[model samples]
Target: MSRIGKRPVELPSGVSASMSGQTIEVKGPKGTQTFTATDDVTIAIDDSSVTVSPRGKSKRARQQWGMTRTIVANLVHGVQNTFKKELEIQGVGYRAQVQGNVLKLNLGLSHDVEFPIPEGITITAAKPTELTVEGHDLQQVGQVASNIRDWRRPEPYKGKGIRYKGEYIFQKEGKKK
Candidate 1:
């Protein structure tokens, strides 16, 4: 049995949930988000909680049960509060800044990289070397942070690049005679 799937997702006072077919929508003070589950699971919405159950004893159904439950929980939480990701640049001249709908990055590359911020997401530069990505949807916020980290990932030799706040990069020793 899946212990995670057994737990119901509780809706806060300002949050509401509705389901249509395979899709579940959660609305709260921050915003609304929706998730579509596979046919292997059945979703139920109670007065203050949501539950997901497997349709059968098959392996696929069992897999979907836990995943669907987690998705529903994420939707409920995301609608109530905004998700955020932080990044730190650790190079000599590397920096990041948000201008309108685009993020300008200077990662010691030949030229600056201009990344256009997608809808429903906001990127902010608290300092020249610190960036914050925020969105109501957890998936989108994480994706944006990953994409930003992809550019000039931390090097094993010098550990100089953009990285998550607490990420650890293993350093390699320099060549010696």
Candidate 2:
């Protein structure tokens, strides 16, 4: 029995959810999001709460039960509020700036890297070294932050690159003399 799956997801005030076959759609102040559950699980919404139940006593059904419930919960939360990811540039010349619909990154590379911001996601640079990614979809926000960080992952030796805020780099010893 999955503890988390047993708990129904409650819909906060101003948030609404509807189901169509296997798909569930949640609408709130931020935006609308939908999720389709697999046949291994069943989804039901009642009295401003959503629940997921396994179709049978099978491993796959149990696995899907928990996953589907979490997905529905994420949809509810995402529509009600936005998700954000923060990245920090650690190199001396590394920096980030948002110009129009593009994010310009200077990570000591040969040329400045230009990342085109997607329609639903927003990227902001509060400081040259600090960047924030915001969006209604949690996956999109995290993916955008990861894509930007991939340009210059922090090195083990110098730890110079782009990294998530509060991330710790395991530094290695320098070359022996």
Candidate 3:
């Protein structure tokens, strides 16, 4: 039995959810999101709560049961609030700036890197070295942050590059003279 799957997802005030076949759509003040569960799980909505259960006593059904329940819960929360990820640029010349729909990054590379912001995602650079990625979809927000970090991951020697805020880099000693 899956402990997480057994718990029903409760809808907060001003949020509404509807089901069409295997798809569940949730609408809230922030935005509207939909999810379609596989046949291995059954989805039901009742009294401002959503529940998911396995279709049969099979391994795949049991595996999807918990996953489907969590997906529904994420959809509900996503529509009600936005997700955010913060990034920090380290090193002497490393920095970032947002201009219109483009995020300009300077990571000591040969030239500045320009990343085009996608729809539904907002990238803000309050300071030259600080960046915040916000969006209604949790996955998109996280993915954008990761992609930006991949451009110049933090190195252990000088810890120079773009990295998630509060991330730790194991320092390595330099060679002796």
Candidate 4:
């Protein structure tokens, strides 16, 4: 009944998927990633595609069907290409730069925030205000970007802070005298 689960994940050229019981391992040019689904869903690998199906008609099984399928799709895509998240710094004297294994951020606070870059991920500052986070794992890339943005969320008053690229911050009217 889940439309998303019905669609098989087609492996692209140079990408392959292998299954062992409930665990699935995907290998691609970028890297190899593995995921283990719960007992509610069944995973199978074919010559050029991977499929997920529910074990029964129960609500949990049906819910896991679609969710498992999407997770498998992400695993496949992640092994082939790296995920990236871009961040933009706003406000006067606000900027970011990457030095060695640390990300230095100046958010106009009393002191600069030094964020340690974790392994398996790369953060690049193309410009003082522009930051790009890249990694083969989609989740890690997004989490790191979120952590960076958390340092200084955009304020509604002046929209001054760190924010994801293309994110819109609704500006509020200034205080009336």
* lDDT of each candidate versus the true structure: 0.92, 0.92, 0.93, 0.94
User: Candidate 1: which pairs clash?
Assistant: none
Task: Kindly list the per-residue Cα lDDT of model 2 for residues 1-177, writing each as its tens digit.
Answer: 999999999999999999899999999998899888899999989988998999999999999999999888888989988889999999898898999999999989899999999999999999999999999888889998999999999999999999999999999999998
Each model's Cα RMSD:
0.8, 0.8, 1.2, 1.0
Best of the candidates, lDDT: 4
Runs off by more than 4 Å, candidate 4:
none
Ordered list by lDDT, greatest first:
4, 3, 2, 1
TM per candidate comes to: 0.97, 0.97, 0.95, 0.96
Model 1: number of backbone collisions: 0
Query: Residue 173 lDDT in model 4?
Result: 98
lDDT of 1 by residue, 1-177 (tens): 999999998888999999899999889998888888999999999999999999999999999999889888888888878889999999999998888999999999999999999999999999999999998888899999999999989999999999999999999999999
Off by over 4 Å in 3: none
How big is the positional error of residue 123 in model 3, measured in Å on the Cα after superposition? 0.9
| Of candidates 3 and 1, the better by lDDT | 3
Q: TM-score for candidate 3, please give it.
A: 0.95
Model 3 scores worst on lDDT over the 10 consecutive residues at: 74-83
In candidate 3, what are the lDDT values of residues 71-131, reduced to their tens digit? 8888888998888999999999788999999999988889999999999999999999999
